[model samples]
Target: MAQQARAVVTRAAIISGAAAVFQQRGYGSTSLADVCAEAGVTKGALYFHFDSKEALARAIIESQHELSSAIGRDLVASNMRGLNAMIVMTLEIADQLHNNPVVSAGVRLTIEAANFASPVDAPYLDWMKAAEVFLRRGQVEGDITETVEVCSAAHFLISGFTGVQVVSDVLTRREDIQQRLVEMWHMLLPGLVPTDRLADLLTLPERIRASRQAALGQH
Candidate 1:
């Protein structure tokens, strides 16, 4: 049991290191050696955890989703539906981006790398599958428009958020970026919300906006 715990710790350390390195150097430039060095593990140890750089990158992407799911798991548990839950989840994700730089970059890197011409791996497809599930949930609850293709919307939103992170330099100005993201989310949420709930769901807390501004001041 103790050894298994250590192994789990080591794998997490490796994935964290890979996220940072891939964030700095990008998917194309990052290598197994870089991950190993950053993780303070031997090549053999790194291989023991992840078979290759691709596998490490895939793990990083999965970790990002796991972290995000944890953030909004409450809404899921509460059976919150429609735009309200989506809004809450979106805000939570934006806050997460502010809080976790490497994971933010990992998300961006995953999308950026997926644009390649060649066939991609299963993990990349899994990321898209997860997004589809989120959007489908919204649609089933009558939040998202039935005509709207959830997968495409998910891709566009992910791509746009990646650009937001790059433009604002999330690491330096997290709050500012987060506020912009929230505003963007608000603008789009109405389209997804049922007409009856639009007005009420759109009314976010003034304190939330104020708190974001205050966070910007600190940065």
Candidate 2:
């Protein structure tokens, strides 16, 4: 049991090391030797756990999702839904992109997924699926317009966020992502929410930030 625990720790270390390398060198340029050096593991040890660089990249992407899903899981437990859930999820993701190296690397690897013969797309699909669910619930709750097509809106919102973050990463290294997300919601919410509801949701981002700060301070 002790040995198995050590093996688990070693595997996590390797994944984290590879993520750091991938973040800096990107997928095409990163090599197994570099990963081994970064991870402080021998080739034999790495091979015991993973056969190829693609496997390691996939693991990194999976790790990133695990982090985000933990946040989503908590929100789910709280029964949060609709635009409130979507806004909080996106805000949390933006914070992760700015603060977490593994997540940042995961996004970078995902973008460079063409390097892999078959890219892992389950994470993206899963997020879009969740968005669809939230949008449908929003319509039922009267937070979303009946005229909106839930599936199409879900897809566009997910893709639009991708573009927003990618542009933020390029232009500001994501320093301004929170503000950018606020701008995004401002432009998009009017079409989704009732005119009466628009004013309240417009300030949701700021309220969410303040709530987080208060929660942290209490701890």
Candidate 3:
């Protein structure tokens, strides 16, 4: 039992270290020796945990997908639905990107490898498909518009979230940009929300930010 626990910890440590190194250096530029050095594990240890760098990369992809799926399930279970949940979840993801070192680095690394033909696409492809499923559900529940174009809306949201992350690191006015994006979602989402509740459904980013700040200030 002790040996099994130690093995799990060692594997996690290696994977985390590999992710950090890959995030700092592109996958192609990163070598097994680098991962081993960062992981503080012997080459044999790394090979025992993962047969090859490609295999490790694949594990990273699966790890990210599982993390994303867990978050999605939690968001949906919280009585949040449709576009509202998406926007909130995406903002939370952005917040995580800003806050979590491993997650931010892993996200950046995964995105950088996104253009290449690799298994890294599997996670995001599954993510987009999940988003589409959510959209379809929203339509059925009368939260989304009947005119919904699932694929296009899903792409737009994904691209918008990706764009926000790409610029988040460089932008000095991240708060303002995030505000603008929430506003943009409000403006655009009406076209996708049911007409009867469109006005009731939309919430301004500024308002949400103000409320968030107020609540935080209370603490």
Candidate 4:
């Protein structure tokens, strides 16, 4: 049992270290040697867990998707209204992109996937589906207008958020991503939300930030 636990810890360390390297260098520019040095692991140890750089990148991407999907699922299970949940989920993802090395690397690799031998599309598809569910529910509950097409709205939200993060990353290293996301919602909500609900929904981004800070303080 101890051996297994140690292996798990080692593997996690390798992944975390590789994520940081990948985040810095990107996929094509990164090498197994770079990962080894970053991880402070011998080549043999890295090979025992990941056969190649692509495998390591894929694992990081999958881990990122899992983290994001879990956030969306948890929000869905909560008592918050669907539109509010969607707002919070977007903010949560922005938070990850800003602070989580693994998620940041995964997103970078996924964007540059065509340069690699194997690319996974499921993560993008899964995220869109998750967002679509929230949008559909919001429309049904009248938190969003019936005129809004759920799938289109989902695509727009994801694409816009992705673009905003990329711009923020380049300009400010994502230091202002949370604020940029709030600004994005302000521009988008006018189309999706009723006038009466817009004021309430527009406040969600700040609330999400404050709530996260409070939770961190408690911990």
Candidate 5:
């Protein structure tokens, strides 16, 4: 039992270390030795948990997806208005990009996956599916216009958010990501949200930020 627990800890440490390295150097530029050095683990230890850099990256992507899915599930379970939940989820992801190295690296790796020779479309698909669910619910609830196409809107939202984060990362290392997301929603909501709900929904980005901060403080 002790050995199993220790192994779990070691694997987690290796993943975290690999994430930091991947975040800094990207998958193509990073090497197993880099991961080992970053993780303070030997090559043997890394191999025990992950066979190769591609495997390591895949694990990171899976972990990231799990965390993101959990957040979406929580928001859905809270009975929050779907459009509002979508806004909050977007902001939450931006916060993760800013504050969480694992998430940041996971996103970076997923984007550059083809370059690493380990193309992963699962994360993108998962995010789009989650967005589609929220948008469909929002439409039913009258927050989103009936004219809105949920799947296409989901694709658009994910693409737009991805672009915004990439630009923000290049410009400010994601320090300004939250603000950029707010601006993005401000521009997008005009088309997707009903006119009657626009004013209230516009405040969602700030509210999400405040709520995230409060939650962080509790921990």
Candidate 6:
């Protein structure tokens, strides 16, 4: 039992350390030795936990997806549904990019996925599916416009977010990501929401930010 617990701790530590390195240095530049040094574990320990850096990156991707799924579930359970939930979900992800190294690393690794052998597109597929669900619900609730094709809109949302975060990371290490997301929504909502709904939904970014601050125990 003690050995199992220790193994869990060791694996978690390795993941965290690898995440930090991967976020700081791109996948091609990062080495197993760097991960070992960051993790404060020997090469043998790292090998025991992971066969290669790509394996570590895949693990981080799994963790990132789980985190995103949890956010989706939480917002839905709290009745933050439809368009509002979808918009805030993107902002929340931007927050994770800013604050969570594991998620940040996940984003970087995903962007650099050409280095990997197998497909790394599942996270995106899942995200687009979730976006479709939100858009579909929003349309039924009369918030999203009837002209907006749910499937295309979902794909656009994910692609736009991907580009936005990549740009923001280059510009400000995602320090300005939430505001950028708000800006993206500003342009996007005119097309997606009814004219009357626009005014109310425009305030979502600030509301979500305030909620985030409160949750984080910030003033």
For candidate 5, what is the TM-score? 0.92
Misplaced by over 4 Å in model 6 are: 214-219
Could you estimate the TM-score for every candidate?
A: 0.68, 0.93, 0.79, 0.92, 0.92, 0.93
- What range of 10 consecutive residues in model 3 has the weakest lDDT sum? 172-181
Whole-model lDDT per candidate: 0.67, 0.86, 0.71, 0.86, 0.87, 0.87
**Candidate 6 backbone overlaps, count:** 0
Instruction: Give the alpha carbon lDDT tens digit for every residue of 1-219 in model 6.
Output: 999999999999999999999988889999999999999999999999888878889999899888877777787666666988898789888878888889989888988997689978987888888899889888889989988999999999999999999999999988788888888888898889989988998777677777877888853
The Cα RMSD in angstroms, rounded to one decimal, for candidate 3 relative to the true structure is 3.4
| lDDT by residue for model 2 (1-219), tens | 999998999898899899999999999999999999999999988998999989888889889989877766676556686778888888888889888999999988888897688877766777788788788878888889889988888888888888899999999999888888878888899889888888887788678777865886898
Runs of candidate 3 with Cα error greater than 4 angstroms are 114-117, 170-184, 194-199, 204-219
- Candidate 3 structure lDDT: 0.71
Candidate 2, residue 189: lDDT:
91
lDDT of 4 by residue, 1-219 (tens): 998998898899899999999998888888889888888888998999998888898999988988888888898788777888888888888888888999999898889887677667876777788788888888888888888988888988888988998999999999988889888988998899878888887777677777876897897
Show the lowest summed lDDT stretch of 10 residues, model 2. Answer: 70-79
Model 1, span 58-118: residue lDDT tens: 6776778678766556655566553455445555676776678556766666566665544
Which residue pairs collide in model 1, if any? Answer: none
lDDT of 5: 0.87
Q: Write the per-residue lDDT of candidate 5 for residues 36-65, one digit (tens) a residue.
A: 898888999999999888899999988887
Task: Show the colliding residue pairs in model 5.
Answer: none
Better of 3 and 4 by lDDT: 4
What's model 2's overall lDDT? 0.86
Please list all clashing residue pairs in model 4, or write none if there are none: none
